[model samples]
Target chain A: MINVLVGSTVLPGNLEAVLEIYRELVARTRNEPGCVSYELLQLREDPCDLMLLECWLSQEHLDAHTRTPHFVEAIAQLEMLETAAPALIYTKSV
Target chain B: MINVLVGSTVLPGNLEAVLEIYRELVARTRNEPGCVSYELLQLREDPCDLMLLECWLSQEHLDAHTRTPHFVEAIAQLEMLETAAPALIYTKSV
Candidate 1:
């Protein structure tokens, strides 16, 4: 399986907007084929800090997710709310 | 529950050593009280990049984990093998 860790920092005053986007994106993404898990976590120390923990059956599955409407829309919305480019770490079980 | 995401980069030629430490650590940690899940993931693009996805029942449970012998030993060993200090994100389900 493929695992994706996405670290994002929301711009000042954009935390609620970012969370709304994530709520929709996560709900839609979880039902997609080959989605093992899709979770959104907010840092306890700083709510503006968000992390997405995603697991997919394979690289192909993850690629397909990126092309889905929910994923594409969420990224566009997040881009505006984010402080900078999100840090993405693609991995596999060790 | 409390979630902790740890990001680490291994020093040059220390991937094997780091993995050994994690193997032992994961095994021991899973058996600890209130450990809901503990996973180690290695980046697909860069093996040196590692991420730990951990879940515990509560803040107190996670605090107890850090004081455990296995955790303490693993941290000491990992500190020598890591390129720099690890990035830690303490979070809760959103």
Candidate 2:
């Protein structure tokens, strides 16, 4: 499996709005083929910071999800709400 | 709980040696007070890359663990095997 960790920070005062979008995005993402697990986490100390952690069956599976309509829409919406570009790392399970 | 995700890269051919150190570290860490979970994961695609994902009762608890003898010892050994500084993110649950 491939483990993906992404850290995204929302613009000031837009945490709720951004999280709502992610709620929908997460719902859709979890149903994608080869998606093993998908979760959205918020930082307790820094509420503006969020994490998207996912486990996928393979890189191909993740690539397919990124190309989906929901993913595209979420990215477009997030561009305006994010304080900075998200930090992402992908690790393959040994 | 505070979730800590750390990504560490081992020098070429040092994966086994580092993992052994971590095996002992993980065992000791799991026994620490306020430790919720502690795990060491290796990247399947990039065997040299490793991840230490932990959940602690609080930041104070984590700080305490870092100051412990086992942690201090592991850090000394890891300094020689790590190729790059680890990437760390601490997230609070919402």
Docking class of 1: medium
**lDDT: worst 10-residue window of model 1 chain B:** B84-93
Residues A1-94, candidate 2, lDDT per residue (tens digit)?
7777777888658888888888889899999999997877776667787777778999899999999999999889988997544434456432
Categorize the docking of model 2. acceptable
Worst 10 residues of 2 chain A by lDDT: A85-94
DockQ of 1: 0.61
Instruction: Give each model a TM-score.
Output: 0.90, 0.72
Instruction: Give lDDT tens digits, candidate 2, residues B1-94.
Output: 7777777898768878888888899999999999997876666567777777778998899999999999999989988988544445456432
lDDT for model 1: 0.82
